[model samples]
Target chain A: MKNIWTIAKREYDNYFASPLAYVIAAGLLFLLGGIFLIILQGSIQQAIFGGGTPVDIGFINQWFYYLLLWTVPALTMRLISDENRTGTLELLLTAPVRDFELVIGKWLGSFLYILSVIGVSFIFAIVANYLAEPGIDQVKMMSSYLGLILIAGALLALGTGISALFNNQIAAFFVTLALFIVLWLLIGIPASFFPSNPAIGDVFRYLQIGNHYESTFNAGVLYLSDVIYFLSLIAIGLFTGVTAVDSRRWR
Target chain B: MIRVTDLTKDYGPRRALHSLSFEARQGEIIGFLGPNGAGKTTTMRILTGYMPPTSGEAIVAGYNVMEESIEVRKRVGYLPETVPLYNEMVVQDFLKFMAELRHIPNPEESVADALNMVGMTERAKGYIGNLSKGMRQRIGLAQALIHRPEVLILDEPSIGLDPGQVVELRKIIREIGRERTVLLSTHILSEAQQICDRVIIINKGKIVVEDTPENLQARLVGGERVVLRVRGDAAELSAKIEQVKGVQRLKSNPDGSLEFEYLPGHDVRPEVAKIITNGGYEMLEMKTLSLSLEDIFLELTKEQVVTPKKKRRL
Candidate 1:
């Protein structure tokens, strides 16, 4: 635990020390702000009896949750891959710290960075509340943010695990992107192809990250099952990363 | 306080190290000499517990590398061939990180001492990317030393350094060796000769020779070979010198000289002089060839190659 905290502090400090982390944070916030502005404009159009609904604001924020799935990989691709490429992995492996400590430290560091970006995007929620009199559902807004954070956390862990498999950052990013795409898009294919067996469809829907994320985001409900699913993904990702490091020693 | 016994590592049938064994006592500096791809780095990695050997065992500072890796890691400091550093981190920050990783209780003092030891105190606040290669190398050494480990394993620590930087690095290594066991790998023969208490030359996944540099040099004194520049019928003198007792072999040089490899403890200079004077050959110059580390290395490895081939067939 002590080693984990030490590694975490260093990893966290690195995000602020290097331009890469700041660039990622700034780019994410900019995109989030732009999306929020578009949603706010649509909300105004609906209020003035034009062509949209107030619920469109909720739908736009849901899209922000999906945006996080893609953006989180960019922040995580270099966490372990760059370390391996630069040979610093050898130094870290030889240190007295355990493998799990290193993995947890990197995961927490990227998580905190993502959290800060999500925090900045919350400014848009405040802006939307001030620009109108109908007001936003504070509970729903917080729940959506919570859902986004959980999804991002899970994706960052998966990205970190992928990064540990290769020394090239681009390869890590693309491989992770491909995996997430397959899991997200192909979740419906199994259900459609095996419709005669409804159990398979039920399992596929449960496996779909988008399904679980939207369930929490749309209803403003933090289901224990949803929380467990994302937490399990994070655990699996970090465990796989630790195993990768351990296997390299024997390889 | 390091001992490796029957250590073998195979990377999918391509063996990197084969039954390699050596020992380093406390306060001894052992030089690991090998060519590129000769398993120097692999052996160092195993010693440092960065990687595990496929077979056999190693004990470092009273801890087994595979069984007690964490304990071993705590007792050993390692600087790999490439100075692995976080380029974005400042020197002090990186050292502190390393200290923490090594589980140093007093990280502040450890970082300061490491920086001071490597003469990197002034550049402690400078980013590693902005530092020169030498400075980065020093920082790497500092990271390794931050925990004050009992045994230090360095793989080509002086590689990629200018002559001046190499000297300074060697000086630091020598100073570090005074109180700890140091197992350093390098292909530079002179570097090993200058600093090593003992040298182990590894070739083709095996140790070809192991001895003190002076002892190894002394063993290469093959009965004194003499190069003589003479103004005479060199071919005839070569033929005549071959007939002299204790003269093992004689060859005539293109420059009208006769070179002789005499038997052990025999000085055939008088015989050569007598032959030249009586046969009307002018002995312009005669010089004894001194064997260098290169010659010793070649001789040892050459013998090693022939013996191994026979053993493999057997």
Candidate 2:
């Protein structure tokens, strides 16, 4: 556990040790702020004219989540790829730390960075709270944040695994971006392709990140299945990550 | 102490280490000498548990490298050929992290102790990227020493250093090897001859010879040699050199030098010097050319190339 934290702390500190943190923070804040203002104008006009809710909750979730698909790949792409490229992976692997510790520690480092980036997006939420006529749904907002965190964990895990697959961080970033884009595009396609067969239909729908979050958590009901689904995705991603790292031991 | 028995490794169709067996006892510095592709790094990687052997076994500090890897890793400190380090980290911060990774109890003391041992205490606050290659290598040694492992495995530790830095790092390595067992691999035979208590020379993934540097040199070239530079005619000097007692063979070099190979158990230098002057050849330089580890390395590895018809001695 100490070794894991030690690794995580160094990895986390590395983010700030370069200009990467500032770049990521600035991009997320700038983009989120622009989207926030547009949403604010739309919601304000609706509130004044038709007695609508203060913020368009659905639009915010969709836009913020779409930004995440790219922002995450940019952040997590270097987690393992940098180590491999610089030969530090040899140092880390030969240390006394276990395989799981290394995988978890790097994922933890990226997870914290992602959470911070996600944290910056909350400036819009705080601003909306003061301006909303009848404040936004707090429980629903919390659920959406929870959903985002869970899915972000899943995405970072996938990124960590993909990072392990390549020595070049650019290759890792582009590959991860392509993967997330494909998965996001396939989210709603299953419903159009498959008729109402609950077993196979639910399988495809549950596999999609947008399906679970948009249908359940974004609407504020924390269904057990949805939570389980996200957890399982996290597990699969990390399991694949551990396998990729451990393969080095054999060679 | 470490022991390897019949350790072998193969990368697809190519063999890297072929039935290699060697040992280093307590306080012994064993030099793993070989050409670049001669399995020196492969053997170290297997011994340090970076990669498992395809067959056979390696035991380090009494723990098996394959079955008890974590135990072996805890007892060993490795400085890889590349000297891998985090360029973003401060020297002290990096050492602290390594200490924590190794679970040292007194982290601050250990870090300071390692820094002082490598003479890098003054540079602890500096980032690794800011340090010179020599300083970074010293910090690399410091990180390896942070935990005070029982065994030290350094692969090509002197590579990419200035000659002055090479001498400095060799001094540091000698100091560290006083108490712990140290194993280092290098293609430079002089580096091994300078510091190693025992030398293992390998070629084509096979151990060709293993002995002390002096003993290996003696075994490979039993005859004594002397090279002389004279101002007079080469043929006349070669004739005079030929007449010296115990002279087995005399060859005249193209650039007016004389090479003499003499019988063993003989002091031929004084006799050759006297004979050259008596012939009125005005000897400018006369030096006994004692065989070296480099000579033995070339002879043994060269033998491997000429015998294509011979079967590999498995």
Each model's lDDT: 0.83, 0.82
What residue pairs clash in candidate 2, if any at all? none
Q: lDDT per residue, candidate 1, B227-256, as tens digits?
A: 888786788877888888888657765555
Which segments of model 1 are wrong by more than 4 Å? Answer: A38-61, A126-134, B248-256, B262-265, B303-314
> Fraction of native contacts in model 1?
0.86
Give the native contact fraction of candidate 2.
0.82
Question: What are the per-residue Cα lDDT tens digits for candidate 2 across A121-177?
Answer: 776777776677665777888898889888888888888888888889999999999
Candidate 1: docking tier: high
How close to the true structure is residue B85 of candidate 1, measured as C-alpha lDDT? 90
Sliding window of 10 residues with minimal summed lDDT for model 1 chain B: B305-314
